[model samples]
Target: MEFSSRARQRHLRLAGDRREPYPHSLQFYQEPPTESISLAEFESFAALAEDDYDARRKDHISHFILRLAYCQSEELRRWFLQQEMDLFRYRFHELTDSLRQKFLDHVNLSFEAVSALLSGFVLRRVCLMLFKIVGLSDAVDLFRARRVFIKDGFAFVPLKDIDAIVLNNYRKNLSKALALTARSLPSIQSDERLQPLLNHLSHSYVGPDYSVQKNTGKISLEHIDALSVKSFPLCMRQLHKALRENHHLRHGGRMQYGLFLKGIGLTLEQALEFWKKEFIKGKVDADKFDKGYAYSIRHNYGKEGKRTDYTPYSCMKIIMSNPPSQGDYHGCPFRHSDPELLKQKLQSYKVPPSGVTQVRHNLFGALFNEALFLNFISY
Candidate 1:
């Protein structure tokens, strides 16, 4: 995105209180850009200079470029899919009734309003396009809810619900397109120029890294146990409990918990001492613990091998990663644990029985405040 000279003429410019300009487009959307956007955007918006590249062509080309870049991994694919779907939903809702029809026509999705089905009560609305004829099984929710009229083996969706049908169709097509793109990776990866760019796109982190903790090493070992009660996140609390009770965690648990602790403030020396003491208290003596476990903790802090400092896994990463196995305590409880098991864990934590409804649909997105999350679940 570019701005014209008139942007400086605007009273409120596109810049944050931090005096920072909005970054590239993806980061621009990922973070709140009110401070940085309005000024620069309006400035750019005002100056439709002759030299400016074609905005429509840029938007179209940019999406295809991203498709190639983001189709490399499951995480990237899902992220792209979600962003595109959200954009579609927003744009669709913004369209006027006539504009919406035009867009549908533009996309070659011919949808006729089913208001013509009945006479007198409602009639004569139907026209050029036919209603999206979906299999009875495909529109089961609409069928069950009695939202759409069924004829023979097809479901006739009304104009209001046609967007949902069209949206699903786009999702399926886009997903298949991504899959087909992925299949071409062998040839694509050999293109030295594109490979590096695609690799970067797949692994890009949008916001602040939890690295360079301001309070690093300020947190003492003794305080960790206290922190677990209410301060630690749900998964971290569970991992801490398991580590203490068993005096050992399998590789997955250790990686997850160890990085989290490092992110919080545990320094290299403290981390080594913390693990050594705990492991010795169990079956592993000091020597065995040093041999088996010491390297991993150091590696996490960028001490060994290639020594690339690793960031702690985000909640999203943990959610997307492999499901934890039995005797493993790495994954999010709301996500990985059985429903009954999750409820029991909440009960064990003394969460009110009445507040356990959030577990019903395995929804964890709204789980910021534990008490309120439980309350929401009950709803």
Candidate 2:
């Protein structure tokens, strides 16, 4: 049986709708001026700028450039920055000294990228032409903080590079998955009114985590597992495909992405609304959705921005890499890749499984409880 078959069955039983394909150009969207800064230059400048990067005030210039550079709108950047700041404050201290130093080193790269954007390095453009210049993976690398989460044996990259790949992957797979969605959930209605919402959920919303955390706190095991199962729809189908086929992550990687998305504001109501729209009959009873899926998304998204909304860092990577424990949700591959272990997991994924370490290993890298989380969020 194909992995999607299992996932599909699980999804259907869990009340997922096979959504219609999103009608969108599969092109990378980016502004031009933001693309001018070279990775080397961005890193060099970020190293110098972090010391000067002010935390108290919004660096409008830096913020603006990043908005353009990443080809995201300013509103998106503001929300992202707010999320990142909140995450960093919670997980910063939990990071090992080595990870902290490494993060600080690359954080400068992020600063430089932002600075370049603020300074008008990129100009507006039709295609994300700048992606070719820097590569999509490199962009995500510039801001990803997962490397700081684990203790050893992995490679790390800057967040700028990481975003590039993640965004591109999302763009590519989202369309493909949407195209196949109708077939996937054939029981659903062709004229479903909710198709647009499904398209939005499947296509527009999912991407990589570039935020950092400032401290670490107790992560509940039950919460971790619940979010793990709940993450499928909120995460892109392609990512879901990658994790299940990849094996090792029946746990780790799946949980990580799930929790991370929860931490970032993808909510249960939104998720349910998304799924129901894709149903074949254009009908998903509210009571059924409530009984089966709604509660988990609520638990995952957490109480309307209160600190109660929590997901563990351990489970997030399942969407990014193989599970650390084959089927358990306790570790991150990017941060915890033991060479021998990685080989086994890779083998399971049919990914050579040999000395195959560090396919953007550094892409790896969160934290805290509610009352304390509130303090962090307020800051």
Candidate 3:
């Protein structure tokens, strides 16, 4: 079964849209595929034999198949470009060392023996091209952050830096192409079958569902304290700590953290006891706890209201929705916390500055991008 499943996935990847070949020219620009392809693709393509027509055709056709779905919206286009770049990088890495060097030469980016002065001169020209292609804002951000260095008013960019530039260029052209495609989508939507398939593909999950859990009853209330210290995600850990220290949590915090505790295997009775004990120790007396908070706790456990077994919040959910208001510690710190406070919190947690920077970059680059993309699609 596993073998068959793998074979099916491989087949789908290589032979996308097997029903009929797209009759129209779907190429985004007049440039030949070799020149128009991303830098990563250029490297991988260079490694292939000249007569490998079947492999080349497969690569060409796959792009158009994706374009069909991805051209539906700006968000989908961005996602498709990222996925293609990732695929290109994987294939490029698989090339032999000699082939990789040869690819550099073929792309006119043989950086190893170039003098620093020459490299800087080349990079300034490349940066100009990038600014024209990707616009000033994105070009500046991409170059300033990675794989480029500046000295004495000129910039030096390695071959690796060219990958980012090429990807950005491809993305810009693709965005324009998608706009053209979108103009034609109304006519294409007349096809009842293709319409649904295109819609499904556009909204499909591109990454793992982080909310999934194989075992729901693995943890017990007795061990939650130790687990929060050692195993909880940062958001949950902070919520746990806040609850412990204050002996109470606001409604937002309680809903967010209570669901988490329930998902980790707290029985309804145990959860009620836990919240009641903590709340009574603070502002809420036993009567107030029973009157106001108990129902919500039971509601989260699926015993009241709609009886929905509400899942614990995923990272994306925490980052993108119902951000913590003042005094609330429930939402994503990366999205909601002040930068200086976030820095101090990370330092207090003994995270190195570099690690903190990396965490911030990953959150902003991946999570925030996804959130924005989702918003684009939904709105």
lDDT of 3 by residue, 272-317 (tens): 9988988888988999989998999888878899998777766655
Q: Report the lDDT tens digits of candidate 1 across residue range 250-287.
A: 99899989998998989999999999999999999999
Ranking by lDDT: 1, 3, 2
* Alpha-carbon runs more than 4 Å astray in model 2: 1-239, 242-255, 263-270, 273-289, 304-307, 311-326, 334-341, 344-379
What lDDT score goes with residue 96 in model 3?
70
What's model 1's lDDT at 292? 90
Among all windows of ten consecutive residues in candidate 1, which has the lowest summed lDDT? 22-31
Compared with the true structure, all predictions reach lDDT values of 0.67, 0.35, 0.61
Model 3 off-target regions past 4 Å?
Answer: 1-164, 167-171, 174-184, 187-189, 198-218, 229-235, 238-256, 278-292, 313-379
Instruction: Compute the lDDT of residue 268 as modeled in candidate 3.
Output: 83
Candidate 2 C-alpha lDDT tens digits along 150-248: 112222333433333334343444334333432434343343543343333222312333344322333433343344333422222223445434422
CA error at residue 126 for candidate 1, angstroms: 17
Q: Give the CA lDDT, 0 to 100, for residue 15 in model 1.
A: 35
Question: Quick one: best lDDT, which candidate?
Answer: 1
Q: Estimate each model's TM-score.
A: 0.54, 0.23, 0.51
Alpha-carbon RMSD of each model: 11.0, 25.4, 11.7
> Residue 318's C-alpha lDDT in candidate 3?
65
Which is the leading candidate under TM-score? 1
